[model samples]
Target: MRNNAPSKHVRIVLADDHDLVRSGIKALLSMIEGVEVIAEARDGNELIALVDDLDPDIVMTDISMPGMDGIAAIAEIHARKPGTRMLVLSMYDTVDFVKRAVASGACGYLMKDAPPFELEQAVRSVMATGSYFSPAIAQRLLQPSEPTVDDELTNRQVEILKLIAQGRASKEIAYQLGLSPKTVDVHRARIMERLRLNDIASLTLYAVRKGLIKP
Candidate 1:
């Protein structure tokens, strides 16, 4: 008997709040062979629902949106659908956004202004391996930076910090990380104390400085 197994095409759910942006990206992806836009979402919440319902191979999303922005959605999707890969397509090219996207479990990041070929390449690389950061992003990540208070945080603390910086409430972080709400609060307090930061605004700025989240 001959073994016959069909290869899977890359199925992507593209999310961007702007209809024109989504349409343009959809058009680009349509031009690439073996790639399919399985669905489209205007916000992170809708993206999550579509991912749960469709189980696409990749989720291509923008970083900023009206509700449940991309970083939070990336974290949630990573937790809920471990097998689904995330590709961030955004206009922001700062190191802060790149680091936060990676930390939040995005498998790839590409600038919106990149050539269409680069977009196709990023999707292929992510699906083939486990991750792909565009050339510009890779170069930025390689740049040296001064150490800061974030260097003092434990890995778990950093995890919680990124979510907090993304504006997730303690209760929401608790649910996402499978920890108690009180535990999340404790971590938040500890994070504040370690960095000598008194308010969420301060912590958010610290996160940006440390390349933990977008400014």
Candidate 2:
């Protein structure tokens, strides 16, 4: 039993490499009242261009694409249009992938195989509440997590730690992750403080022990 209001128009731009996948998703979206499939893109680069041109209300996208990838595109789109809601429609559900997508500014994460009903629910939820995550994803995100002893680092901090362990300088890491150099440095300092490690050498050794990086 449910009570609902009349649906307002929701313009969506979909991006995926596969034609079949995009067609199926577009068909599903079409069934949901008030949802319009305004544009389609085959890759991140094309998606960025479409988003820049159409300015859709939501961007439903996949994680892996031929050129530029969805995470990088989502980051760029979010930077330019913070008002646009990003909903990731991908098959990857690993913690790393989920964390990276979220860090890159996707407010919603729904698996491609999710029940068709869940798709409608996700769309309505994001439009109403400003965010949505599949039950499994939300569970994984809420679960306790830590890569090292001492204290827990945030997903962003752990991401930075791995890069630092790989000997990536702050500027380079910042560029790759779409963050400022100062933000990377701040995360580095916090990671070291939380782990009680004083130097890059120790941090790198810890990362290796934690299997964050290969020796």
Candidate 3:
């Protein structure tokens, strides 16, 4: 248990598109001592703006949002405020989503259905050690990396391919992954060539068939 210093409370900003979900999470967070929910955001854009204005110590956010999406916002926030830690609270349990959140610089990831005790534990763990993950996620991370697509595509390429299949432009992918547009383009070209895909449609189809994205 982390005993926060008397003068320093853990300030947090909560972000989730659903009002009820955000309210429930806020209520739960309010139960923890030495923690404060300074503000709330309904979407990733709003979360980004709030973070810019409030500069909270931690950002607790859901992965999916209507505009900008949580992963993109996390990446952007990491770029702008490297010191502000990101903690993800989401229902998405897939390893892909977990990997993406971590790659975007989130220090913690908790399942929404996790026990209430884990909430405060996660907050304290993040503040103390700079990281926490749901037990299931941690286990998955420890297990051997699951084979994705084909053996030819590197992990980074597979990540970029997932974004591209989701209709993200190269510039957006670059921003999300902290790569230059030229680098993203080069990767995209390589992916296309390696997969024998000539167009975005074919690539998207390939991604779907390979379980990279839902149809």
Candidate 4:
């Protein structure tokens, strides 16, 4: 909803390597109600530092940033501040890139070429519902596929796995799920054992393959 109230508006820090891209997105967002681009970063490293400092409601970033990739930055930011939402705004729309971005804790993914209205809608959707995927990306996730490790996971394990894939630390997951940190760790261990996932990257890939995330 468009609103004059500061609390109702979404505050965002945008990140992209190209100065022109950042400026163009900032301008587009400026025209939308209830959306404000509060700061900008030219690379993922700078974006991470800015996010830590600014603590905006959302971080909108390009995937192919310099100094550090956007996916890594998203994971880092999510680990540090799970409350801040992440959106990937990039030219790349491939399934692999989309999967990695969402696996790393991004709440939304939009191609840079999306209509201005779609961008606005994505920002609002993610802010309101905790996640959003472009229609194209969503369709890819719905395609039929062979059963995988996910089928072996219990509902609670799948829930924890998604959060883990989204880069929330065990303690943060514990708080969100109303479980102790130790319990979260136990679940995580069991998940990894069941899925034969040795690390976070493996778990993230599993999440992507299972269609639990964007890819």
Q: Who wins the lDDT comparison?
A: 3
Model 2, runs deviating above 4 Å: 1-6, 144-215
Total clashes for model 2: 0
Q: What are the Cα lDDT values of the candidates?
A: 0.85, 0.85, 0.86, 0.81
User: Whole-model lDDT for model 2 versus the true structure?
Assistant: 0.85
Clashing pairs in 4: none
Of the two candidates 1 and 2, the one with more favorable TM-score, higher being better, is 1
Tens-digit lDDT string for candidate 3 (35-112): 899999988899999999999999999977765668878999999999999999988676666777888889999999
- Which candidate model has the greater TM-score, 1 or 3? 3
Stretches of model 1 off by over 4 angstroms after superposition: 1-7, 145-215
Candidate 3, position 31, lDDT = 84
Tens digits of per-residue lDDT, candidate 2, 1-215, equal: 12243268999999998999999999998888788899999998999999999999899999777646788789999999999999999887766667778888999999998989888888888899989999999888877654332136776887788789888999999999999999999999998898889999999998665545546
- Pitting candidate 2 against candidate 3, the one with the higher lDDT is 3
Error of 3 at 102 (Å): 1.4
Q: What lDDT does candidate 2 reach at residue 30?
A: 86
Q: What is the lDDT of residue 69 in candidate 4?
A: 65
Write down the RMSD of all candidates, one decimal each: 6.7, 7.3, 5.7, 9.7
* Residue 212, model 1: Cα distance from true site in angstroms: 11
Question: What would you estimate as the lDDT of candidate 4?
Answer: 0.81
Model 1, 1-215: lDDT tens digits are 11222156889999998999999999988877777899999988999999999999999999877557788799999999988899999887777777778878898999999988888788777877878898998998898744433357887898788889899998999999999999999999998998889999988888776655556
Error of 3 at 96 (Å): 1.7
Give candidate 4 regions above 4 Å deviation. 1-7, 144-215
